[model samples]
Target: MTFSIIGRCQESGQLGIAISSSSIAVGARCPWVRAGVGAVATQNVTLPALGPQILDLLETKQFDPQSALDHALGANDYSEYRQVTVIDTNGRTAFFSGKEALGIYTAVAGEQCVAAGNMLAGTHVIEAMVPAFQNTQGSLADRLLAAMHAAMTAGGEAGPVHSAALKIAGDPIWPIVDLRVDWADDDPIGQLDSLWQAYRPQMQDYVTRALNPTAAPSYGVPGNE
Candidate 1:
């Protein structure tokens, strides 16, 4: 029901995740990232807690991606029904697709990224995502969006995906980019891409507003008017 990629940018040291699913609001549940730590995607039966659990292990406990995934999955009784992937700060990766994952589920790991999907048209859907992320240029968000497009080109979800999300964590305590189309009748990926484009130019303004409101530029909103 969902396909996603968790990746790290080697040049900028950013961690991000891009995901889409037949289900509504996949972003709220499946993807998690912590700056200077790692990223995690928990799908299939969808244990939302697993995403944070993995990140916490990586951030606080000093566990690598593989060990974090193993410890998290090992503690779950329903492990057989879950699918997850993790990428650490060092670009080390690990993944698991349980025995009970839905039709045509598979996972692929590339240089600094991992793509995984369940109830997909075919394994190639995930396969295409790896190179797309690896070869694409520009921001981590751009590469992630490219990977999502590649997945769709190969044969997206088994059914229409209503929701898509892009999340990136850079040097800040907060995410640099977090956009989502919670539910869309048409193309969620395109909608998400549009949101990124609109947000990109002002991405720094948002952080400026947070850290130094006096120094941030005015958006000329209703209150400012």
Candidate 2:
């Protein structure tokens, strides 16, 4: 069981997804985002391939979120077992929760943001994330993480979530933020947020190292020093 939020930042045009699940290594399966394309989260029965496939439709195939979702799910024999959500460059969102989605499933679509979950505690689990994503201050990563925390407070999955991930795509060829707590017997969501906190201040430095090594800052580690 999993719950996730996908959002596009209005000011930066960045896309991000924050997700947590009862399953192990959930990050390795769900939550995909491309810098200039879009974001997608495929859960429920969890066909991991659908993440990249839907992103392809949004990028090269000239498909909107809704069309891409329709085309992707339409082709799958087990489509009814999937719960997928999509958001594109234009801030449009599309979400589908198949009939066979796990217990107490629901979704919420908000401005430039959307969230969905299967085996959630209730619809409020999805509903609470919307306003948190909308009103939270800071970067897109910050807001996405905030929404994730809100989901837990609102009553998360029908069961305790053991794994979590949050990813954000900026202008770089690589992800600006990709943090995961693959499996935590305790609170994976909190651990994921703590990672974001540790990573945020250094995010730009990593990009600088990649794009222009000479201009990058010191690593502040033993060998690097």
Candidate 3:
């Protein structure tokens, strides 16, 4: 029902998440992230509580990626129907794919990133996402968008995706950039990437307004943080 990519940016110290799903309103059900904490993708049977619970664990420094995931998985009975990936603030990453998950899914961790997805066409789908993000250079949001594009090009979910979203959180407030194509035509991934790119400048402008109000354009100036 869903395919997601969750990770933290090594350079900006920001966290980014992207997801696409054949089910309507995918963003509402999957993909959760918090800056200065960690990121999580909960799918399959879906455990929404794990999203904030994992972030709380990371925030208190009570556990690392592996242990936090272990603790969360240990406390849940539906572990077999769950898929979760975590990338902590320090860049440490880990993930678990339930044995009962649909189709094929794998979570891969590298020096600075983690990539995970299910119901993909093949193993290369997730494999291509991370390397593509690593090989590409720019903002963390751009890299995440690239990863999503790579997965889609490699054959995303077994069926057409109805919804897609990208979330990046950092200092000051909730999220620095958040965009969602809750429902789209046949090409949700491509449309998601386009929305991300269009929103980048606005994000920068908003940040600028936060830090230096005079520098922001009258209309571009964002509200009080």
Each prediction's number of clashing residue pairs: 0, 0, 0
TM-score, candidate number 3? 0.91
Where is model 1 more than 4 Å wrong at Cα?
223-225
Off by over 4 Å in 3: 208-216, 220-225
Full-model lDDT for every candidate: 0.94, 0.91, 0.81
Write model 2 residue lDDT over 1-225, tens digit each, in one string.
899999999999999999999999988999999998999999999998888889989887578899999999887779989999999988999999999999999889999999999898999899999999999998998898889899999989989899999999999967899999998999999999889889888989988888898898996798762
Which lDDT value does model 1 have at 25? 96
TM-score, cand. 1: 0.97
User: What TM-scores do the predictions have?
Assistant: 0.97, 0.97, 0.91
lDDT string, candidate 3, 1-225, tens digits: 676777677667898788888777778867778868888878877888888887778888989988888888888788999988888888888888989988887777765677777787887888888887888888887888888888888987777788888888887557888788889877887888888777776787778877898897566336634
Report the C-alpha lDDT of model 1 over 1-225, residue by residue, as the tens digit: 999999999999999999999999998999999999999999998999998889989988568888899999998789999999999998999999999999999999999999999999999999999999999999999999999999999989889999999999998998989999999999999999999999999998888888888898988788751
Cα-based lDDT at residue 92, candidate 3 = 89
Predicted model with the maximum TM-score: 1
For model 3 the local lDDT of residue 89 reads 82
Instruction: Tell me which of candidates 2 and 3 scores higher on TM-score.
Output: 2
